[model samples]
Target: MLYVLVKTKKGTLVGNYSSDKAGCILGRSSSSLVPMAGRKVADEHAHLEERTDGLYVIDGGHRAGTLVNNVRVKEYGPINKDDVIAISDYRLQFRFVRIGNNEEDSFSKRASILPVKSVEEPSPVNNEKMTRWREKIRRSLVSYMDLRRVNVADMDDDALRIFTAEAIDRIIQDHEDIDSEIDKDELARQVLAEAVGLGPLEPLLADDDISEVMVNARDEIFYEKAGRLNKSEVTFTDDAAVISAIERIVSPLGRRIDESSPMVDARLKDGSRVNAVIPPLALKGPNITIRKFMKERLTADHLIKFGSLNKSMVSFLELAVAQRKNILISGGTGSGKTTLLNVLSNFIPDNERIVTVEDAAELKLYQPNLVALEARPPNQEGKGAVHIRDLVKNCLRMRPDRIVVGECRGGEALDMLQAMNTGHEGSLTTVHANTPRDCISRLEVLVLMSGMDLPVQAIREQISSAIDLIVQQSRFSCGTRKVTSITEVNGLEGGIIQLSEIYRYSQRGYDKEGRVRGDFGATGNIPDFVEELRSRHIEVDMNLFGGAQESEAIQDGF
Candidate 1:
């Protein structure tokens, strides 16, 4: 059922509207299906079209702009439930509630994984005297800056930190009521973090060992190191302080988060992915999760050292990429799919033109002839939005020898496969799947998601011809991620796509320390394409095939 919630400046009203065969019009005019009342609303502001695949909103070419989730959009659809629609002076929660009756699959039918939560860890510096001293220093710092009419935003970063640190020092020394036993330097750092940085998160962000930071609430902060979760001993002064830190992270990006848009996805200047959730949905408080990007670029040798794969696997991947064989990296979340994709990307020779497309620019490709395109979120006015599918389609015209997509999450899967089949061969991408067989099924599902009316057999044929290899990277329960298997997309026969496993990881068992005990071995089954294209100057070490005759005979009659 489709539900429409009407919100005015005075209050909110719960109501329902009947859907017409053509579509529903949301505007101020009485004739509009959902007659919005406001001066900013146009007579026919936007049209909502419900297709078999999903619901889409098309702008009526109005200058005010049509919006979804506070994002001004010209034409966007498949708007999932729980999404807020903003028009002129009105806000509406548009939803299609399907409560477990799976008569048909829809947005609400998909399962969701909630953010990780941990218990609050008390700060070691959170003493009564120290808290008071820090609060005093913060107040004094604000007064000093205001008296001098200092514009923190305009000041150079280096100059600002130095100036703030010195001012904090002066505030501490001028006040004798403050405890001397308190580490003055640490106190100053805390004050500075509160004043100019991400409050308590500054230290975690600065630590080289920390990979992920989670803020469940003002007092609950957790971090990840070497795949182990540990609660941090620091926190924001309050919920408001937590919101302030979020603003600081997003302000430079010209992004805003508030009641209308309580959820946001962003990245730090260093490319670390950051996500924030605020009130209404986030009951506890403002929460932030930051996944730090690799500071040092990793190479294939690094993967070898990390045991993500062996020398033979890396050699085959390097050759596969160089030979213009389209490769897909498959894994679950946090399974190091992106890391492996990044390492394998450098395998592309510097001489070729490379195009990288992503939702947020993360791939740090060093190729001189590289064109990076990042998908853009809708502007505040709901305009100027670009999606991964559009980027994948447009990059084809850019004459790139290799197309590196950061990840394929939607209809873009169809376009990516088409690109690989149409001569842009050495393209690389990552997909969310548990195993190589599941990877094939996942691709089929994603391709069908494109809303193309093609038959299943046709899609299977496209997959078999388009993709050459699949590298299955997995994160074991032991908090370690490594390549579990590498398979070949041999061909499609009957109605099934045939797969041959080239390399596989055999896990004997977990060691005494709980670390995964596994070794990588080669599957004797070789790719038919390798044998057919032997004359193409691409060399494959035949000896590597003697280790194991890996049968991905798992899902193929094709």
Candidate 2:
């Protein structure tokens, strides 16, 4: 990887950046990758470009000019890493570092921190020039505090931010030139955000409409809003800066990521999911994908309003959950499985003790009697790893009235099936699958992953008897997620599990506005346990699922 170390006139290392990206624009403007505040630097001074011949420094046609090794040049080398490229008062050195190779570590790399730790810190951020000044001012504040023997560890967040802001003002006034183009107020704000808050992500997280934030590179970003993806105007200073942010996130949770471990799964204070990739694994430079959590907990009514499901499905799920029926939710990534699970979980009576197992705890259950368990990855020493299967096994010992495994991705499926069959009737979990039939096959594969050499027929029988319902969630071309199918596991027939769909979503086509035009219809196949529900004195409107019925209250025209 190509690296750049930015130094001051006094030779203080300020910013460390590295990327194999084609080029970098350096100037006084915020758009420049290495922005300088000095008056001698033009707004668009110079840039570094990697060519077929080699890396070269090209002048940006400014009279201030680009210099390399103390000589004025309109253009410079296929530059060596040892070369020093200078513009204005700052010194820049390029270097290349090699990283270790290990493509097979992807699965273990995504391990999540046990018992997720989240700290609620808030601040604003932006790309490039602001990124540089944020670093400089942040360094200045730390130095000022250190030189004066200030112990900031004991100070509260508000106190520290206030103190840091004052020190930043003093540093700029005493150090930076008066004619420099840097905006002091903006500098102070960015520094404060980086030092005390999430920097750049604060605004994105605060926007309720945005569901996700993607960091592709230092100066490029994207976000999902209104079920559509769009480019974001925000960015970071460089790859190193992005790495720093990733460290800040994983470190607080007692998790570590380095050359040995290059990826991680974490959660924000609001329970938003976080995944970061760096170096050899990420060719585009450091990458971060954040799935933002909702501020308000969603209920069945919300799903109905959003055209995800209708009253009949909600009513059936409520009865099933209350009756202690094991349910397995299936969906592709980000298809609202968790959200639907969260809503369905609420159906359990408050009197029952519920235990939830997850990789990173995202469910927000309001029941007074509830225990949530998050999975743990091995530490730096490669020991004490707690997988989802272990959590499921432990939950069985807790005497939980209801067990909810967040997702059955591995051997946990076997343990979950056993728990469901062995009197943990109301257990719930999810898996990645496209259809109800695929869900059965997925469960069989997950069961085999348990390391037991059980016969295929036995595994099929175990699944058929344990899981009562399979709710398939799907994300459409228009980005709307809906319940595509809700099928009941009737029984094992000729070594195959029989599935009868009680409800399904049929999309005729897309509308003029490109929104999916679909309707949730009843397939007229009632659950095999419906008679048992009636015998137990539970009431259900059987006619609701008698035939093709669309939810009349949908506002999205589904």
Candidate 3:
């Protein structure tokens, strides 16, 4: 006889099931017994059976679906005995205990063993035990004040004591249960060690000094601080715990990762970007990377203040957007591509209808006429999935004045370029490329992924005509992300696309603090749309193209 403990929303049931006599227990509830031989009943039914290593299954009935750990299960499958299961509106949790085990039975247990007269033999005793057990469990739980005292006493040192206390407070506010005892001291110590290990990298994330976090396993956790890679001492307990923590973080956000699905990309509440992968694909235990965002959305003024761009350069960009120029922000990964895109998007009119698409929705637009769309992963059965390309094609019918793609990574590049050419002017997007020249090549490669057989020249022609400006940004060694070049496409010449730099960042000498010093300056060639900015009463400084003296003067004021 196998003793089973079943907990459901209505109550609790302590019963036993025999595989030989019942074939398999079938019922909508613990009280109902339906045979499992008929086609309808066989297709949809719930039952429990022992499996190796403490696992069981609560199969779904035909009309009602089964859920494991609150996640809906599409078919019959193995589940751990401690797993929480849900069927339709009701939730059930199961635990398997061997009869005559040495451990003392919980308060919920009725007697040593109930006689198996029928399936309903223990019904009366089950009800009495559930009520008594709930009260006992409630009293055994610890209070928040007790947890705070315990965590404070466990602090090993001064620095850790302060950090642990603050971290514990944050966790308490974030978690739902205050009465549940979770060994707060241990939790606090672990989380504090995690934060301290991050070190200077923590300030970079909070200061908005960095834009991306890259971790190549536990030994190497790097962040793009000030547009350059900065190494930090962030370490995890072990590869297994790192994988477990990453899974815990992503799963709560409606995402999953395991051997079956080894790769996952997710976003944090603050719009930080996250990507994680686990072994056998990873080979390492599990790898996680996060790209932190600025607490405040960067505006044109902020760039000017940071000396990344001058007022004249800002004026030129503002006019370029106002004139409906299709702009592509190009950079390597973690080079502030999205940050620059967000800053430039501020120039978009407040009243024009806009549509933004991304794999994970991270763009924060202040425009009232904005609609954000995100891609969806397929269900477990590999159905009901939506891709970025599908969203791009559908955006065409949405009557958008501006179409903003958070990033063009796949076949959607072709559709986006087509959208730009077909009157979706002022469309803004970002792409990962080493330089402006590489951006065109990346677009061509992505267009080919669409399965379109257009010639290379035709693809280049489409790129040149569709994109008016390429703003290249990079993270320097000092961890600064600056707009390196703003080049205009001068159309195709000699079967090659011509690019002329309108603005460029000239490297000046480093500052007193040994940081990279640079100034944004124009190259003196008149843009095709110079008259458009002139119409807006925005003047360009001719000396901006002359020499370092003018650029130096502009930097001193900042």
Per-residue CA lDDT of candidate 1, range 30-117, in tens? Answer: 6776655445678888887877777778888888887888788898878766677777656665555444534534322221100011
Runs off by more than 4 Å, candidate 3 = 1-235, 238-240, 509-514, 532-558
lDDT of 1 at 351: 99
Give candidate 1's TM-score.
Answer: 0.74
**What are the per-residue Cα lDDT tens digits for candidate 2 across 287-375?**
88999877777889888888888888888888889888899999999898888899999989999999999998888899999999999
lDDT of 3 by residue, 399-510 (tens): 9999999999999999999999998999999999988999988999999999989999999999989999999888666665677888898899989999988888888867
TM-score of 2: 0.74
Where does candidate 1 clash, by residue pair?
A: 72-381, 72-382, 72-383, 73-382, 492-558, 493-558, 496-558, 523-548, 524-548
Model 2 spans with C-alpha error above 4 angstroms: 1-129, 172-184, 551-558
The clash count for each model shown is 9, 1, 8
Q: Rate the local accuracy (lDDT) of all candidates.
A: 0.77, 0.77, 0.65
